[model samples]
Target: MSEYYGTTVEDIFKTQNKRFRAEGSEGVDAVFAYDVQGEGGGRWKLTIKDGACATEKLDSDDFGEYSVKITVDAETFVGVTIGKIDGTEAFTAGKLKVDGQIPLMMELPKLFTKYAPPGKEVTAADILATSESRFQPENAEGLDITVGYNLAGDGGGQWTAVIKDGTCKLEEGLRDNLTVCNIVKAKDFVDLMLGKLDPIVAFGAGRLRLVGDMEIAQRLPKIFSKFKSNASEPVEELIMLKKIISVDMKYSTGPTMGKFLNGLKEKKILANVCPKCGRKQLPPRECCAVCRCDVDEFVEVGPEGIVTYCDIIYYASPDPLTGETRETPYGALFVLLDGCKDREALWHLLKKEDLVDVKRGDRVRPVWVENPTGSVYDIIYFEKVR
Candidate 1:
């Protein structure tokens, strides 16, 4: 039996349970019958219950009413499952035939995660050979450097990339006086080249060791194009629209929040003190959540505080205030200000430059604007106090 893209018809069915999305299967009760033809093909019944799925192989005796029944060749079934062939195109070409409910069959892809074949292991030699081919001469103008790779462990060997005069050449073994030498395991080197491992994370984790000029190491990615896998298939590009929809709106801040925003103009981080329990509300709420008592007295907390929690946001959507998208990788920090008690942490942004070094218990001070605004935007963000 032949396989399509390293995936057999049986392989696709066997891994269906692992790929099944329980969340998507909620309230979905249906049976899907697959009558795959050709070698390595067989009849199978996939039954989905409330947040669960089960697959049973059928013999010549088994035949039951199903919500949807699909008939296709083994190779086409495997190809479509792994995204190598388009299912809609196959159906139009009469290679794939469907019976029973068409809408249920159309929504089948959402019921389970996309099937991914176990890819062929990429070797270091395969990556090193493409150095010259993947080099971008346009980005390498006036560049002269030797990047040494002292890869160790299985399938490991020394190699050097001599980049000079708008060209790059891969050479076997390392040479003396290298600009930057990278010491890492061969498996990690392969993952790093494939972008499976982030270079910053690997460096911080000590999995990747770099010596000599650090600046050139950062520029290497720009000097070379990304490496492509030999066994990978082309993916369908998704259509995306960049549009900003703006709506003008305003709301009354009320007495509690009004004082809070007004205090920002005086460089104050105000929190309302509860008259009963003494628990402070970071944004100066009208009532204390614990004691249910009115909070009228407000006190200043901190322009500087210690971070209780930090998150480096990589995929930030457009800001609601400005309707403009921020740059990639910004920090969202929850800070425990000096005068604030437990559960009274103020939520704010941290400086982008400080994200790499910021951790819990780290001291941070707010970086305010020249002219204070009567809003939370008075301070741009917080930065680590050196």
Candidate 2:
């Protein structure tokens, strides 16, 4: 039969028993007639009484006594039945004509749930097309095997899946040297893939016949993910939280950090030198970590430095100072300043435009603000010294 939007005119009437709601027809007695014109269209009658429904296809022009009659072209008729076109809009646009009781016809939609076109039948071609993507190379490691499928009946085709050394390749038509072969009807294979039929049950019932290696047949599940039906599934609304939390707090920068920020106002990098071991702290520390000696000597490092490491940040977090997120694809750099050595890399931001061109050991200089505040953000960011 010809179809429109994957559904034929006869398909709508054929699904009446499956879509009927007896409870909705309580205390209702009516006959609904449909006169669909054009190719692939016909007249049908629906009688509802005593919480039951009876459907009939009329061969003659007689509609008998219908409480309501609807007339429309085949395309619009199917469109309205499957909810592709709004019934109210179709009537208003003169695409649909109604006669008899208007009040009874208004209750038609409530009598049954909305119609959906039955999903297209899954075929061997469809399942095999997705086999490579669903293959689990980790499970197939160190294994070499050829699996052949000989699906019979409609929508069936021969295919071979070859798995070797952590990779899978699918070939059309069966191979003679298959390690294992599966023989089943195309419908059963589709049902098995959809989890609608059990392999154990089909095999026990002689519906599935296996040839060649038996162990390899059992290992098929481990080599591939479960086939997901392309049919539409119901979706539920997802819960979401939309808010930006702003915290108000402050802490005093002690002597060590205060001195470091003060140096940025003059476009200088400061470091504290440990007297005992001579370890340089880029952001000045009060005491040496290794030597356990109190550090007091301050040294000016570099406004220019070579990058020791760099991170191209794509996902950015909110800036604590501004309470806003930075634009992405920015670079965070760890620079070894001129006067500092031996792992004394200072952490700082890099210019966004220079992220792609900058690399380790590339010299960079801090771009200072016009009017500097004694904050780390005073220097906008370091730019690569091209």
Candidate 3:
């Protein structure tokens, strides 16, 4: 039996779990050290104590303060730290060197269990099964979605997804409303599912591309953020990544916007008509300084429209409502309603390619969901009638 600081890793994990279970406590005063091997013959020290973890250069003066020391062969340490093995596997590989308390070392597994990664090898069948087990009325209330992956990265791979309230049965080489894409690798696919990569980043970086539902790209981040890992990764590199792209989409909506949303539920399109030029606005407004009139009329607009402009979407958000980000290249169109004039365009999903025949005056009709609630979303969007 070896020791870690004055304890064993396994024992530490057990004690921590017991304490957490009984008293909802984390570690009180504990310190453990690891000699990690780098890509070269280099090594580093990773220390955790009093619920804080840190990494340092191998030969620093900080080594004197560690309470427990675990030395391992350099190669083994690198593999373990980089997620190549479990604690037990590392020990069995003759790569672990524990010096402290054997009892604490024995508890290492229990502690690691608390920080376990999400399950590996989640197949399409596995996700479908989980969806079935967790099926609820609320989950089925919104849109019906299908997800697929092209693990080959060549965009010529089989795709699978779980459908809500519908069976994904392929008949005569046709699937019902199935969306597909050319994915290159499973890791990239999983990153998309986990919302780690934005649709734009994935496509622009040559990771993934969309074959359908470009709006799903914008909604994917919101959906995947719900399942984000509780653990935090080292931010040294990530912070630099953030600096390169400085746009964040999660903005707060105040009480005024809340009122406007309520009005949309009543099937009224509220606009902030400019008093100066008498221009009917699209998004609602509070004041009109040009004419200095408070435009508060809840106007009823037509459910028919024409496509004025459109763009493709291939990105994900961190919000949980939208599931994993879809592949790149879905259509978003700025629609001009039949009865509204003066830049009154509604932004919503359009099931068309950017290179399609749609232009400034394509006829379109609002595709309303059953039992409209008057919310702007009450009508999904206007689709080209032809």
Candidate 4:
């Protein structure tokens, strides 16, 4: 089918303009242009003039009066428009490249209607059962690999994709399922396809597990493209959907631990040292795991430590604490405090810039907020020492 059903781009703009007007034209007067390539490749611009929207197909890269411009493949543009791809996530993922007014580009999603490409009811079985049909032989070119999906639920069903010399055939149940298997809840499989969930975070959180042939699992992203479906407004959860749960919490911090929390206000690192094992616990564990004795000796270790392990979080769901998500491309790390040994480590955040330079054994320190609070939030996060 013609992308967006032939001659529909302008119709989309008209509809978008109506939506913008209803929302009282949130942005300043400006021209927004999309330089699209691939399948439905073309240049189009939507201009906001005196609170009204206008559109036209452009003939060149000469930006003209446009203040914000983005260039992306026709497929990705359609995915973004249809809500299969979150606009901000696509930009961050480098699928959408932009120049000129960034703030305006960021506002475009809110100015227009969120569209869902026709098939919103995609289920886990539908995705796996149709694997052979959904397969792009060209992408599988020069490669042969079998993939298996172990999805759980009422939609629960086993599926297998047998690939040989750039061709794929499907099966209803597992056969060599462990060749390269993915185990996930049927619902999460739906969210993964719909862009409501981030795969990297899912893997990190153990919600999605891949066993055997990890390299093949990583290739999954490139081998398949966006699925075509229905057109409707995107949901309020176009970004990341998370539940806001509130509860009362209380914890017992006896005399020993209480002193440590009080010392945080004075900017001291109080680690409980186990005399028997000579290991220090930064959070001040009541007892050492190795020695099996109460940690009585307090030793000051660090507002600084060395990174022992880290991973880049390119995508993730909302933070459970604040009900909000942090910007992507941040790092999650394990740091070993100075003067601390026996593999005792503290986990925290790292900056994007430091991610490239910081490595195992590289020193880091914590960033703190204005007022000192006994809770963990007293220190904002960790950063590279240099």
Question: Best lDDT goes to which candidate?
Answer: 1
What are the runs in model 3 whose C-alpha is more than 4 Å off?
A: 1-263, 266-276, 289-292, 316-323, 326-328, 352-356
Best of the candidates, TM-score: 4
lDDT of 3 at 51: 53
How do these models rank on lDDT, best leading? 1, 2, 4, 3
Tens-digit lDDT track of model 3 for 1-386: 34322233333333333333212215634455655433333334434455544444555534565555777754454345445556666665656766654345544433343322222344333332343333343433465676555455333246454445533321122244655433456566555555676757888987676667777545444433233333333335322231333456885545445556665676655554554676665666666555767765545565677788877654323234433444344677888776777567877777554336556778777666676664667767667777
Candidate 2 lDDT over 1-386, as tens digits, reads 77888889899999876687887887789999999988889999999988888889999769989998999999999888877889878987889988776557656766876677877766778998999999999888888999999999998889999998888999999999899999999889988888889999999999999999888889899899999878665557555674667787698888998999999888777899999888899898889989888999999999799999999975455665554666666899999999888799998899988977888899999999988888899988999998
lDDT of 4 by residue, 179-266 (tens): 6988999999878877889999899999999988888788877676665444343456646564667798997898778878877777
Cα RMSD of predicted structure 4:
19.9
Alpha-carbon deviation at 245 in model 3, angstroms = 18
Q: What local lDDT does model 3 show for residue 196?
A: 70
lDDT of each: 0.87, 0.86, 0.52, 0.75
Candidate 1 backbone collisions, by pair: none
* Superposed model 2: Cα runs more than 4 Å off: 14-29, 47-56, 59-66, 110-126, 132-145, 150-157, 162-169, 179-192, 196-225, 231-386
Q: What TM-score does candidate 1 get on C-alpha atoms?
A: 0.44
C-alpha TM-score for every candidate: 0.44, 0.43, 0.32, 0.49
Candidate 4's displacement at residue 231, Å, is 12
Cand. 2 TM to true fold: 0.43
C-alpha RMSD between model 1 and the true structure:
24.6
- Among all windows of 10 consecutive residues in model 1, the one with the lowest summed lDDT is 314-323
lDDT, candidate 1, 138-170, per-residue tens: 987888999999999999999999999988999
